[model samples]
Target: MNKRNFLVTGASLAAVALLSTACSTTGGASGDPAAQRAAIDSAVESSLARLFQENSNAKELVASAKGVLVFPNFVSAGFIVGGASGTGALRKGGKSTAHFRMTEASVGLLAGAQSQGVFILFMTQEALNSFEASRGWTAGVDGSITFVNVGAGVNVSTQTAQQPIIGFALTNGGLMGNLSLNGSKISPLTFN
Candidate 1:
């Protein structure tokens, strides 16, 4: 290869390496559990701030919800082979309600990325019942929700936000996620 071509190849490789490193680094962890936990705390603060801004019956849900969980950064990867997992917490009345795990997996067709999103689970009997009785849930399945960009949801204010469509009537394809939040211990998030 010519000198110029060699230099170009080296530069490209370096760029890819930096990008890969950034992709894998979530919540600003210094490769330490404590740092990651700190990142999680910050993410939760942002989630709550989002909660105040978004008017999605989140208030009503929180009012009656058994708890609210905020996942500031949930990362996953997949392609020929796939497995995913992330950490988040449950909050009640602006406090740490509980900690929960979220995961997804599949075989054959796939897409991979390190991503961040929000999850609102209603624990109260009424809220849970409403979720169950809903006719359908669409993450963008039928346009009930709008995604300004691929994999991005508009922030939920009083109403409307981009969506990842985790659940709803229109959620289709992909491996169904396993969510076990029932009766899970919850600790309210403390902003102070």
Candidate 2:
């Protein structure tokens, strides 16, 4: 085979391998609805604790938010073609109202894997209602999400907090940088 052809073939194989591993690790539970619910609940609890600790203002946001979508562990891995997936629960008034899954695909200058917890706060009742009404909600297009940067202290003023939606992404440990949730799609999941 020619050198160019050989290189392309090798790249394709590597991409496939990376995607397979990512899927297996991040895929939601396939059986046992009770067990899956337990896991998601635990993750949401721990993740929210961490967020509240890191960003004190998050407490206020959570209290004021009409609903919150928490993805405890979203994993992303790629080589050329990349995707991310995670399972989570939506909570209203401190109780889980529904389960949801987040998935996204991208092609760009990126490679490697990352695992992070994401919490999206729907600031307005209308925003939360619109999201719950949709069969599949795509980020950025459906609504603009502002990712709060906690590094600068908890200064999320009332004006900024008034945005329709806000998000926070936290990584446990990984080589990934500049996390983006632009094209991610979130849909409700019914566990059987």
Candidate 3:
């Protein structure tokens, strides 16, 4: 096989293995559909509560946002090529309007394994509407997300607050450092 094909195959295999391990540990998203939805909802609630407690700014953002999407866990592993997938819910008017699955893959000088929670806030009705209307929304192509670096004692800046869409990555310790959702894809997750 050519070098490019070899690398692509390797990356695909690595991503599948990593995601499988993650799902198994986190009550795998297979099996009962009701169970999977419950798991996602439970994680979203806990993660959002923790985020709000740690940073009041996030709570305020949620209060004002047209929609809020939260992914409670994303297991990421990579060696040159990497991928991450997580289940989450979209909240409108403080209730889950829909469930979504988010996945992202990248190829670059990257290597590591980590898990994190992600929050995306749509500050405008237009943005939220567009996101919901899409069959499958891909970051940076379908729409752009302004990523905010979050950490202990970190404050959301005024400029960041004004963005149409904002995203944050958080871990057990606290919010992860700089990260992006550039190539991430979001799709509706229907429960069977």
**Who is ahead in lDDT, 2 or 3?**
3
lDDT of 1 by residue, 1-192 (tens): 999878655654554444355434545657665665567767777755554444344444445445455665445455444444445665667776444454444344544444545555454445434433444322223222122221123233422322222221101221112332222222222222
Tens digit of per-residue lDDT, candidate 2, span 1-192? 999878655765676676566544324644788777877887898888887777777888898999999998887776666678888899999988888889888777767877798889999999998999899999989987887766425587667688899888877641122456888999887676
Checking candidate 3 for backbone clashes, the offending pairs are none
Per-candidate TM equals: 0.46, 0.86, 0.86
* Model 3 residue 126 CA deviation in Å: 0.4
Residue 5 alpha-carbon offset, candidate 1, angstroms = 32
lDDT of 3: 0.83
lDDT of 3 by residue, 71-178 (tens): 898777787777888878999998887888888887787777888889999999999999999999998998888887766567889999999999888887887647
Model 2 residue 104 CA deviation (Å) reads 0.6
Which candidate has the highest TM-score of all? 3
TM-score of candidate 2 against the unseen true structure:
0.86
lDDT of predicted model 2: 0.79
Please list the C-alpha lDDT of all candidates, in the order they appear: 0.44, 0.79, 0.83
* Total backbone clashes of candidate 2, pairs 3 or more residues apart or in separate chains: 0
For residue 71, what is the lDDT in candidate 3?
Answer: 87
TM-score ranking, best first: 3, 2, 1
What ranges in model 1 sit over 4 Å off? 1-26, 29-36, 51-56, 125-192
